[model samples]
Target: MTIIRRSLGWCAGGLALALAATLGGTSITTAAPPEADPPAMEPTSATSTPGENYVALQFGVFMHYGLATYVKKRPWDYDPHEVSPLTFAPPAEMDTDQWMQAAASSGAKYVIFTAKHHDGFALWPSDYTDYDVASSSAPDRDIVQEVVDSAREFGLKPVLYYSWLDFYKDGGSDDEGNYHFVASPEYVQFAKNQITELLTEYGDIAGLWLDTAPGKFDSGRLQEIKDHIAAVSPTTAFVPNTHLTEKRGGTRLAPADVLVHEAELEGDLPCDATRPHEQSFLAVQPNSAGWGWWSFASRDTTVTTAQDVMVELMRANSIGGAAAVNASPGPDGKLGLGNVNLLAEVGALRTSPTAYVTIDDMVPPCGGTLTYSGQQTDSDWIHTRGTPTGGGKWFFGTRTHSNTVGATATLTFSGPDITVLFEANPGHGIAEISVDGGPPVAVNTYSATRRQSQPLFERHNLGPGPHTLTVEVTGRKDDASANTFVSLEGFRINASANPTIVPVANVE
Candidate 1:
């Protein structure tokens, strides 16, 4: 949930995608196969890691709940009444499992619930403080415990968002010194006491998100806290997201087990899948009209928008990092039921069970494509396109081969001169093509709208041999993946042209 990401960015809603939610009604649909793991997220035609520990998950729920939800005021509002955790607010009867099952059906693979929000209200009983759920009128119920149990029953990864500074707890802050003892013993013990209970009581936490550590990094407290978690469970990821005001990012003072960057990625700050994807992850919640917990002020939150989720999905999948969309549950312990239901209806992904391609083999002489070889698993395959949601072709998420940076691909040429027909720009700027090592030749250099074209016999003469070809893509230079600005359905070889099928070598 709070695992760190590598960039600081602001994104816009250039294109809109809808999110429709479906109530998890009737009875729980007995579990089916795990929502097939999502197709592997691939970097822009490049490298691969052999033993990766993370999954490229597209859907997750972020709940900014706990006692803080009811008290809309800043989490720091200290109400020493030490409100009973459950009494924090009486929400409509909780269908905790109902929501969990809804998430499962709505394609969500994980849930990041707030265990202790920035306010430091523990959702479960903690031996550390009286300011917890146990003190709440609902003291009898362990909401966090129930949420985790329900999440597991449906196979959702339950990542906990824990805060580092407990404005209310003794010694929970970085800058405070006096009143409590510039260095009070209680303050020191409180942090440990709470963190210990979180790790020990929660079963196999998927990850821990640490927020507001202030200058704690320099003091080596970040690592100390991480060590505490490891002592309880070494397999989990200890992600510390410093509200760092620096330019580089919001990673831990030191290289943490994982890095996290929050809401800022507008420069050359690589928030996507090429180059080196930091083990970094990001939490981006796009603003509708403003930055608040209420439905992005009427418009969907960044996570609810298609374009929003798509950008994050691309950035994380390509770079091999986790992408978490920030979603805050309303004071009612719900993601604004209406909003959650909306998110469930819209889907852009073409689940693997139904994806296929059947186009020509003759590329526009711009580049040669390496056809799919094996049945790629969810994380290993996806469809890409040059447009937001238009003509894009399916390709291997892990497919990569070398053909020189500036070079185009083609096979030998021969057989007949029959004109090869395929999709390409015929009415737009110079439609170009290149094969094997030949220079890129223009097909029709003029046109109006974007249109597919039949090959030009004038420049394309064949003598029965094999040749590779590629088309120069059109769009922002930022676009790089094969799906960049083009829908790569297979290509068509001039039926009369000679052809050879060769298996590209060393592409594992």
Candidate 2:
């Protein structure tokens, strides 16, 4: 995930542009696509793998801290000269235990702390860089150590989010004036040294999360990173925020144990067999619109409701990925009352009257046939046990580049509510869908990332009767899309004689 940061002490100029890039969903600039092997595939039911545990952490907490916490502004917006170590200070009442306790109460299995953000401010004392907690006013305090210790105490796995870009180091600025360099061997080695320190010093880190793909490294450098981390922490899972799907350079990514989806989870995209997928998003507070600092005064407005948190978790679970919700601590180093209460509510749901809604594959009526078009063959309608890796059993259409626009699949079933679960990939095209001869709705099935069994279309309250759902390939993609191909996974029908609307408030 792109870090929205600015210098605490510098004038905002290029930093604003950088902040815009992160906010607008764009990377600063990445190196050319690296030549590497495709990500390895893991069975949906694989166990004892390093990533298996990480994947099981369905609900986790993400906290972004560092200079931005004190600056109370976008830390990525400031230049090197704009930042000063003198301005750094540890919270007067530092309570790492409080954070962990809150996480435990919220039923979170893991906690991922921002060990270093884009501002290049290290939460831990690093011998390789003076711009760290050790060189600042809080020289004696190691925020990373405190967090690690507290996580262990609370029985929560501890993970670290490390930024690849550093503005305060020798590579002061890239061509865009961002803190990162276009290509700097000095910074690369610096990263290795700091990572070694973190792996060697920190005891048993569950995962190492790298922010923004290394816009600089090809497979060689990426492989080097994996080797180094494996040497110290062989079991540690490596997850890169590849963002929106394609690898850093638009090619294959250097192999990692897991793949990360920053925010969006499209239905057509399936999880790669080589790596499991994770979904991380902004856990909204009352008034805060984005993922960042929230002052005590802003607490009232930035608070998030417990209902919203539950929905996010449920959605990720439905799609076979973990959800890491972002939450920031106040300057005092403690979570707000509103966040604590929300988490408590979520924890309560664990043992309450929860209805496990089972999603079943739609079986065509005995006489009805699912017609297909294009160069589609009988073999194209392949049955997959768990698509999008870990998704429910379903069938999908598969074929080569036939460019057979207008190819379609039509299904008629007796149901009041229906949902189409489709695959969205970079090459997917637009799909025209209609219900019972209703007006056609064009559903763009294009996605940068791969996800399977994504709930693409749904219609409820159709009244007791049979309906026909027809899906046709438009054989077209938006200018930004990579291809004009389309995929049809399957459908989910809710044909219950009576449907109950259970209010969360009524759940015991």
lDDT of 1 by residue, 1-508 (tens): 1101111111123432222223464331222122222222222222422112323343455555666555545465544234334447545476677657656654556677777865566787665555566556465678788888988998887877777666556566545421122324565456655656665677866667666445434436566666666655555566666536234353436535545555443221233222212222222245432234322222333444433333343334333344555445554455544445434532323132112222122121211223322221222223333222244322211111121222222222322222333233322233345655567655432223333322342334544243434543232122222322222232233331111111121122
Please give, for residues 43-80, the per-residue lDDT of candidate 2 as tens digits. 33334665766866767888766777777666676654
**Weakest lDDT window of 10 consecutive positions for candidate 1:** 1-10
Model 2 residue 306 lDDT score: 55
Give the local distance difference test score of model 2.
0.60
Model 2's number of clashes is 34
Each prediction's total of clashing residue pairs, residues at least 3 apart in sequence or on different chains, is 67, 34
The whole-model C-alpha lDDT of candidate 1 against the native structure comes to 0.44
**TM of each candidate vs. truth:** 0.55, 0.59
lDDT of 2 at 218: 57
Worst 10 residues of 2 by lDDT: 499-508
> What C-alpha lDDT do the candidate models reach, one value each?
0.44, 0.60
